[model samples]
Target: MIVPIPPGERTYRAQQAFEFAGSDLAGLVLFDDQLIQYFTGFIFIPTERPIALIITREGERILFVPRLEYEHALETAQVEEVRSYPEFPGEQHPLLFLSEHLQQLGLRRGLIGVDHDGYPPVMGYSGPALSELFAIRRVSAALDRQMALKSEPELSLIRESARWAGHAHRLLQQYTRPGLSESEVEARATREATQAMQAEMGPGFRSHNRWISGAVALYRGQIGPNSALPHAISINAVFKAGDNLVTGASAGVWGYLSELERTMFVGEPTPQQRHYFRHMLELQDLALEHMRPGRACADVDRVVRAYYEREGLLPYWRHHVGHSLGQRIHESPFLDIGEQAVLEPGMVFSIEPGLYVPGLGGFRHSDTVLITSRGAELLTHYPRELEALIIPA
Candidate 1:
C-alpha cells in the first residue's frame, strides 16, 4: 500500500483552499487531475472520462470518479467516502451525483468556489450549469497561488527528482561519443537513470508511481544546427569533431520533475563557440546570483536581458531565464519580464539561460533550483565548465 499523506496535512490544504476560496464560498469543486491528486494522493492518468472531487468548507470530501476507477480510488484515497458514475455519457449526469452529494451536505444554496480552468470540456460534461444550483466564482488563480508554495514533502520529491536527473546526465555523458547517435545516448541515459532511481528510491518509494518511468522526460542531446534551434528534436545528428552539442534532460520521480542541461563540444570548440559558451554560463550565474527571497522574479530576467542587449546579443535570446517547476513541469511565477511576483522561500525554479545562434549551435545550460532566504540553492549540480563538458573523441 502507498504511504498516504497525513490526515492533518490534507485537512490543512482543504482549510487553506477554503481560505483562498473565501469563507462565503459554500464549497470548492476540483476536477483537474493534478489538483485531485494533491488533495487525495490518488494518481490517475486523466482521460476524456471525467473525475471530480467535491470538497465543502466543513472539511467534507466526496471523491466522484468513473465506476471503473472506483476500486483504485478506494485503494488510494484517504477520504472514507468514495463515489463514482457508470462512465462517460452515462444514464445519469455526473453533476446530478454532485448535486445529490451537495444537497446531502446541506449546501443546497450558496456561493461555490471552482477552478474554471480545471473543469472538463463542456462537450464532455453536458450537465446543467452548476451555476444554476449555486452561484459560481472562478477561483483558478487562488488555486494556483495555493499550490505555488512548495511543501516539505513536495520539496523532497523535487530534490530527489533532481538527483535522479543529475545521475542521468552522468550516464548520458558516459554514452556520448563521436559515432553514437543522439537517440542512442538518450536511451542509454534514460534506462540507466530509471534503474538507478528505482533501486535507490525502492519499490514503496514511489511518489507518483507513474508508468512513464522516473526519467519520464528523459535525457536528450542535440548536435550542431539542431542545438541552435533551442527546442528542436534531434535529427539523429552524428557527433562530429569540434561540433557543439546541447545535452539536456529532465527526470520525473513520481510526478515531480527537474531539468539539467549542459553545452559541450565533441572535442575542441571554435573560438566563436567557446566565447558564446562562456557567456551562457555567466548569464546563468547572473540569474542565480539575483535569486533571493524578496527579489522580484522579473528583475532577474531584466538584469540578464540587459546584459544581452548591451552586448548586442539580444537577437540570439530565445526565452526567459527560467520558470517555476513542480509536478506540472511549468508553473507560474516565471522568471520573465512580465512576472512581478516576489521570490519566496520554498518556491522552486529552473535557471536556464541560453544563447542560441543559428549556424553557430546553441550555447545553453539549465538547472533546477530552490529559492532560499539567503539566495538560490542549486539542485542540479554537474560540471558547468566548458573544458569539463568536452567529450574527448
Candidate 2:
C-alpha cells in the first residue's frame, strides 16, 4: 500500500527552496514533469497538451492545465488553485492566460524562477517564450541540489524501491536457465514481478504507466558471450549452459529507484571466468569502501581506476564507478574521475565496477548505495558472491 504525503509537506518543498534562495525571486513556475511531481506529488499523462504550476511571492499558487485535464488536477494536485484553459491552439496561446493572471495578481515583470533547464518548449502548440511573458531565471540546478538531500519520506520510497527491485532480480534468476530464450525469460519475469508488486502495493497505490510509481522487473537481461558488451543487447541471442549472463534490474516507486545488477553463470563457470569475476567484485568493494560523507565524488573514482590499472585490468574498465539517482534515472553529481561534487548525507549512488572481456561476458556487480551519517548503506542487497550467483546446470 502507498501513503500519500500530507498536503503540508507537498508545499513545504517549494517554499523551502524559495526560503533557501533568500533573493530577488518573486515566484516559481514548474512545467517540467519531474519538477511537477517533486513539488506537488502529482502525476499526469504527458500529451502534447502543456501543463504548468505557478507560485507567486505572496504565496498564491495555481496549476494551469488543459480543460480536459482540469478534473484530474482537481482530484490529484495538492494545489489550492487550478486554472485550466480551453482546447489547444484553438484561438489562443495558453501562456496568454498565465500572463494575464500573473498581471492581475500584480506579478508582471516580476522575477519568476522556472523549473526548467532553459526555455520551456511548447509541444504541439505555438506560444511565445516565457521570457516574453515575464522576467525569468533558471532555478533547475538549485532545485536539483536541494532534492539531492533525500527527506525522510523520500528515503522511505527509496527503501521500498530497493525491495521491489531486489525482488525483481530474484525473479530474473529464477526464470533464467539454459536453453531459455533471453527475451522470453526477461518478459515473463518482468510481468510476474510487476504484477506481484501491483497486487501488494494495493488500492492506496497510484500507478501510472510512466516512470512515476512504476517498478521495473527487468531492465537489462543479456546472456551468452554477447553479454560481454556493456551497453548493447545482442540480437537473436540465446541462453545456454556454461554461458555467462550480465543482468540488470531496477525497482522504481514514485520515480525514486534502486538498481541491482549481477554477473551470473548459467552453469559451473570456467576457472578463467571465476578469476575475472573475483577481481570485478573486489573492485566494486573497493569503490564502496571509499564511499563516505565529505569525500569528493571524483576522488573515489580516481582511487578505483588506479586500483584497476595497478591490477593490469585498466583496459577492461568501461564507465564511471557510479552516479547519483533520483526522480530521473541518472542525475548529476556523477562519480567520474573529474566530477567535483562532494559526497553528502542523503545522496544516493550506484556502486558498480565492471570489467568486460569480449566473448567472456561482462563481470560486474551493482547496488544502489545511500550515503549516511555513518557510512554507505547498500539499498539493493542481492547475492554478489560468485558462488551465490551460479545457476546450477
Candidate 3:
C-alpha cells in the first residue's frame, strides 16, 4: 500500500531548513517543475510558459502561473495565493508581473533564495534573468540534499511503484516470443499491468504522466545487437530466436517511481551470453554489497570499477554503477567517480552495472534499492537469474 506525504510537510521542512541554514534568506522562489511540485503538490504540464512558487520566510505560500493554469492551480496548489500572467511572451512579459508581485511582497531588495537565476528557456522561451529584476541566491543544492533523503511516506510510494513494475516485467517475459515485434509485446504487457494496477489501487490512484504513463515496461529498442547501446531508440523490428534483449520497467505511484530492468533471450542463450550475464550479476552484487550508510557515493563506483578492472571487463563498462532516484527518474548523489555525496539511510537508488559486448548484446539488470542502516534493501522484486529470464524458442 502507498502512503501519501502529509500535505504541507515538504514546504514546512524546506522553511525549517532555510531558517537553520542562517543564509538570511527572505524566502524561496522556485521555477523548476520538480522543485515546485516538491514544495507544493500542484502538478502541471511545464511548457514555454513560466511558472513560479514563492515561499516566504513567514511560510506564506504564493504561486504564479499562466492564465490557462490559473483555475487548475487554485484547485490543486497548496498555496495561500494563486496569481496568473496573461500569457507567455506577452506585451508585459510574465517576469514583469512576477517582479511586481515580488516587490509587493517586499522581497525585491532582500536576498531571496531561488532554484534558477531565470526561467529556463524551455520550448523556445526567452525571458529576463530573475537577477535583472531583484536580488536572488542560488539555493538549489539545499533542496537537492533534502530530496536525496526520502521520507518514509515517499519510500512507501516508491515501494508501491516497484511492486507494479515487477508485475509489468513478468508480463513482458510471458508475452514475448521469437516472432513478435518489441512494440506489440511491450504495449500488451503495459496495458494489462495498468489495468490490473487501476483495479487494485482503486479510484483515488492517479497516474504521474512522465516517461510512460501509469505502470509500463519497455525495451527502448534494446533488442539483439541493439541492446549493446545502453540508451537505444526503438528499431521497431521483430524479435528473432537467439537474440538477446534488455528491458526497462517502471510504474509511477503518484510522482514517485521505481526502475526494474533485465536481460533476457528469445531462445537459449549461447555459452558466451551466459558467461557475460553471470559476470554482470556478480558486478551488481558487488555494487550492492558496497552500498551502505556513511559510504561516499564515489566509493561504490570505485569498487565496481576495480572488479571490472581485475576481470579485464573495463572495456565493456559504459556507465556508473547507479544513481539516486525519486520524484525524478535520476536525482542527486549519483554513484560516480567524482561524486562526493555520502549514502544516507533513507536514500533510494537504481543499482545497475551494465556490460556491452559488440555483436553479442548487453548484459545488464537494474533494480531499485533503498539504503538502510544495516545496508541496502531491494525495492524491486523480479527474478534476476538467467534461466528464469530465458524464453522458449
Output the number of the TM-score-best candidate.
3
Model 3, runs deviating above 4 Å: 1-3, 17-22
What is the lDDT for 283 in model 1?
Answer: 95
Among all windows of 10 consecutive residues in model 1, the one with the lowest summed lDDT is 211-220
lDDT of each: 0.78, 0.78, 0.89
How high a TM-score does candidate 3 get? Answer: 0.97
lDDT of 2 at 309: 89
lDDT of 1 by residue, 342-376 (tens): 89998899898899888778888989889877888
Ranking by lDDT: 3, 1, 2
Off by over 4 Å in 1: 1-7, 122-129, 207-212, 216-221
**Residue 94 displacement (Å), model 3:** 1.1
Question: What is the TM-score of each predicted model, taking all chains together?
Answer: 0.92, 0.91, 0.97
- Per-residue error at 305 for model 3, in Å? 0.7
In order, what is each prediction's RMSD in angstroms? 2.6, 2.5, 1.4
What is the Cα-based lDDT of residue 73 in candidate 2? 88
Scored by Cα lDDT, where does model 1 land?
A: 0.78
